[model samples]
Target: MNSSLLLSLAITGGLVLAAIVAYNTWTLRRNEPKKAQPPDPSAPSAPSAFGAAGMDPLLDPILRQEPSLDGDLAGSAGASPLEGLDRGQDPHDHAIDPSDALRMPAPAHMAERRPGLDPLIDVIATLTMEGVVSGDAALAAFPPTRRAGSKPFAIEGLNDATLTWETPAPGQRYRSFQAGVQLANRMGALNEIEFSEFVMKTQAFADAINAAPDFPDMLQEVARARELDQFAGDHDAQLLFVLRARQAAWSPGYLLQNAARVGFVAGSMPGRLVLPASTPGMPPVLTLGYDTQAALADDPEQSAIRDISLSLDVPQVHRSEQAFARLRDVGAALAQAMDGVLCDQNGQPLPAMAMDPIAADLELLYDQLDARDLSAGSVLARRLFS
Candidate 1:
C-alpha cells in the first residue's frame, strides 16, 4: 500500500460520512411538524379560512373583541344632534341631522316579550289571590325544589305596581301568581306523574298565599308535552367533525396554539376551547374538544393527541350567524394547519360533499322551528332543547 493511496481513501471516506450527515439532517427537518407563528398585532388580519365570501366579522382573529352593542347604541342614541343650538337661532339653517330623523318604535307583535315560562312549553296553573300579597310571603310559600322530575318548576308573581309577571322579589307586592312546569326537554316529555307533582306543588303554594288555584286538564297537558318533545327530537341537530392527525401527533400546547390562531379561546373545562358567539352572553357558536386526560397530564407538552372534535349545537345558535358555515370553515382550517384529516365520529373521512346535505337539512329544520314559533336561538328554543 502506498501513502498516496491511503490518503486518497481516507479523504473519500470523510466525504461520504459528511454527505450522509447532511442528508439525515435534511430528512429530519422536512419530516418535522410545522410550528405556528406567534400572532402579530401589526399584521393585516388574515381572511376567512376558505375565502372572504360570507365571512363573519366576529370570527376575525384580529377583531375577536367585538364592540359592545349597548356601548354603540348609547353613544349614538343618547345624544340629540340639535343640542347646543341657540334658542333664538332659526332651526332651518342647519343641515338636517340624520340622527334627528323620525324613529319608529318596534311594533307590539315584533317585540319579543321578556323571558318567562310560556304556555307553548310550560303547563301553567293560575293562582288568583283575593288581594295583593307581599312578595316576601309568596317567596316563603314557594316549592323547595325548582324541578319536578326532569322539567323545571317556576313560579311568577304578577307585580301589582309594574303590571308585569316575574319571579317574586323581596319588598314587592303581587296581585296574582302563576306556577309552571316545563313540558319537555332533552331528558324527555313531562309525564302524568310529573304533572301531578306540579299540581300538588302549586296547590300547596296557593294555600300559603291565600289564593284560589285553577289547574288544567292533566291528560291534555301531558299530550301537549309529548307533541313538543317529538318536534324537538325531529328538529334537534348536533353536528360534530373530528380532526385526526395524519402523521405526527399533537401536544396539547401545539394543538392549542393552532386553535387559537383560528379564534378559539380556552373554555371553562380542560381540553376544551370555544368560538364565542357574536352576541355577548349567548352560548358559544362552536366548541373544540380534545383528550381531557392529555390536558390534565403533568406535562401536557409531552402528551400526544391524535384527534380533536369540533361540535355545533344547532338550535342553540342563531341562523343569522351562519354557524354551520363557520364550523365547516374552522374544521378545514384546523385540519390544514394541524396536518390532519377531518372525519366523522366513526373515523370516516368527511368530504366537502358530505356537508352540503347537512346544510340543506339544517335549512329545513330552521324553517320548521320558525313555523312552530320556537325559532332557533330564541329563549324558548334554548329552554326546550335543553
Candidate 2:
C-alpha cells in the first residue's frame, strides 16, 4: 500500500465515526419528551393587594405596590395627609391616634377582627349628596327634592333621636346622646352593624383630613372651654363651636364638649377624647345639655344650647345669626380645603377652578339656608318640649 493513500483512508474513517455520533445525538433529542413550559410566574401573584388575585379591577396598580387593607382604604381618599388612621396606634384597642379624626365607631370587641368603612361612607355620602345631610333647609333650596322619607332616627345626628334616661336625682340631671337612623316616622337607634360600619368608614375619611387641622376662620373666635376641673365651678367654657370640619382639624367641639361634660367621653383615642370633670361629690352641674337625639317632626328639641346661656357672663342668644350664617358660607371653605385633593376615586382635582365654584356654591347655600319657605327643616333642629 502507498503511505499517502493509507493516511487518507484513516482520516476518512475518523470522519465517518464523527458523523455517526452526531446522527445518534440528533435522534435522541427528537425522541426525548418535550418540556411543558410553566405559566408566567407573575400571573398568579396579584390579589393580596387588589381584589382576590384573579378577581381584582385595581389589581394592576395594587400588584405594583405593597397593599394594606386599612391603609389602602385611607390612602384611597383625599389629600388629607392625616389619613393613616392606624399608623402609630394599635387598631385593636381602638387607641386613637391623636393625629386623626375622633370618629371611630363604637369600640371593637376583639382586636383580631375588623370591619370595613367603604359601605357605610358610601351610603352616608350618597345620602348626604341627596340632601339628607343638607337637612330640610337645604331641601327648600331645591323644592323638587324632598326629605328622604322619614326613617328611624339612625346616625344619632338626625332628627327623632332621643336620650330618654330617667333623671338621676336632685342637683343632678342625666342626659345622653344616642344616635338613630330614620327613613320615615319609623325611626330607631342605630343598629350595631350600621353604626360600626359608619365608624370604620368614617375613620378612613377622618384619617384623610386628620393632620391638616383646619383652624377657625381668622375672623371667628370661639372661646374653647378650659379642661374640666372638679373644684372649678367658676372655670370658663367656650361660647360656640365654629364649623371647623372644613378647615380647622381640631377635634370637633361637639365631640370634645360632650366628652368633657361626662368625664367619660366614649371614643377611639384617649388623647383626642377628653371627658368632662364630674366627681361623685363635687359634681359639675349639668347646667346645659345639647340634644343630639332625633325627635318626632312636631316634637321640638334644641340641638345646641347657647353657650352664652351656659356661660356665666352673657346669658342670652348671640342674636348675630353669624354662627348660623356660617353653615352656608363654610361649605365653600370646606370645598376649598379639599383643593389639591384628587377625587380619591379618580386621583384628580375636583371640577374646574374648584375653588371659585366652592365660593359660588356657598353663596347659593346662604340663600337656601335663609329661605323662609324651607326654614322649617333647614337646620334639622328641635327645642325640647320644656
Please tell me which predicted candidate would have the highest TM-score against the true structure.
1
TM-score of 1: 0.76
Q: How well does candidate 2 match the true structure in TM-score terms?
A: 0.17
Q: Judged by lDDT against the true structure, how good is candidate 2? A: 0.24
TM per candidate comes to 0.76, 0.17
Q: Which ten residues in a row have the lowest lDDT in candidate 1?
A: 70-79
Q: What is the clash count of model 2? A: 50
What tens digits encode model 1's per-residue C-alpha lDDT throughout 1-386? 59999999999999999999999998866555444355576877565443432223333535443322111000011112111111112222222222222123322222233599899899999999779999899989988999997789999999999999999999999999999999988777899999988988999999998899999999999999998887776665566667889987887878877776676766656777777777886777777888889889997766778888877767777777798899888988888888899887667888788788677666766666776777777788778777
Clashes in each model (backbone N, CA, C under 3 Å)?
A: 0, 50
C-alpha lDDT values of all predictions: 0.72, 0.24
lDDT for 356 in candidate 2 is 48
Error of 1 at 179 (Å): 0.3
